[model samples]
Target: MSNERLLIIDDDVALCNLLSDYLGHEGYRVEASHSAEAALQRLADDDVWDLLILDIQMPGASGLELLQQLRPRLRTPVIMLTGRGDEIDRILGLEMGADDYLGKPCNPRELLARVRAVLRRAGPDAVVEPRLFPEQVIERSGLRLDPGLREVSVDGEALELTSAEFNVLAYLMQNAGRVMSKEQLTELVLHRKLTAYDRALDVHVSRVRQKLAPLVGDGVELIKTIRGQGYQFVKGSA
Candidate 1:
């Protein structure tokens, strides 16, 4: 694990140092930058980073701005840090390509856990054994999915998908033409039991819908919402 490099970008020098020391102790080669400029320089150097810890509020360039620029070039899994209890910031971060978001004054252990989870999901090593969907590429209603590569395309164009978004698409593809309830999707796709009124699945579904917007208005709704039930994949097309 020590071989895996993590970059910490935050203007809070004390917090950055503390995180570097702690994450280093936990078997990660951690690097810290007090400004977005330094962070970009480190990123441009082509150093292989397994994960990124980015703070939302910074002096020169905001973390969100850096993330917007980095998304096009960086593939490192990012866990964003927002101000204390800023729910809107957290949600915005996730929508802006962050793998996860943590509030300020966070627990170190919890942050470490989130880092491990994001790495596991984003890493190629996440899928160890042969998967049923391995090497399987499915195309239905102009929705193209390649599970082996964790990619989805609409109308032959690549779609930007978060890990959860990809999981939702994969689940729908696997159960093409079958309606799946939110509970089932939350459990099966997310690998966790669903609690009452958990709307994360809905949020991810909306994101996927945005990615598949090009397929809309073509008599082929890739995902069909069943009024009382959940969603079903419209099978048999591109």
Candidate 2:
């Protein structure tokens, strides 16, 4: 079975069907919604979606508007579709954290190609950009994180973390200063729901903090709790 799922939201019925057929043929499990309301409903049901194909212009809520509403709540990469070839819309879309943008009346092959590229880029298993540190390193403060090796450090040493811990840390570190809600973080990092009694994330966070206690010093707090919100990393200055 294919490892990827795609959701396409567009007002054009033919375009949606065509995309659904083409992407399904390309070995992806695909779902399509013709309106923003339907799309939101689909997303809210908390199914796993690898990517979102969103149309900028629509009847109820615009694609850009939907993206604005969803970006903080979801981490699925979006490829926005715009009817007008406006540079402004393109820039705005990218600024709002869209993975890519395309104008309509484009070739189906081209759209498919863009979708493939975006999916590959967004996939966690896909090749990531080079980082400064080794794959795994344990520093004195219990901060064990190997960006390259995708490892974790603790208390000036290394910790054996599961896949979920690593992914949660990676997601938090990527948005170090931002206070992400539990729902938002769950959606963005796990791309899935936070199940009942799933204190897995909280447990991981506690472990990470404990590991780094030694290095935290007096003023250095790696992860800070935001009241009623989520967590944020207080990055230390050199």
lDDT tens digits, residue span 91-146, model 1: 66665568788888778899989988888787776533223232478877667787
Error of 2 at 204 (Å): 33
lDDT of 2 by residue, 57-88 (tens): 89999887677657434667898888766777
lDDT of 2: 0.70
In candidate 1, position 195 carries an lDDT of: 83
Q: Give every collision pair in model 1.
A: none
Residue 50 Cα positional deviation in candidate 1, in Å, after optimal superposition = 0.4
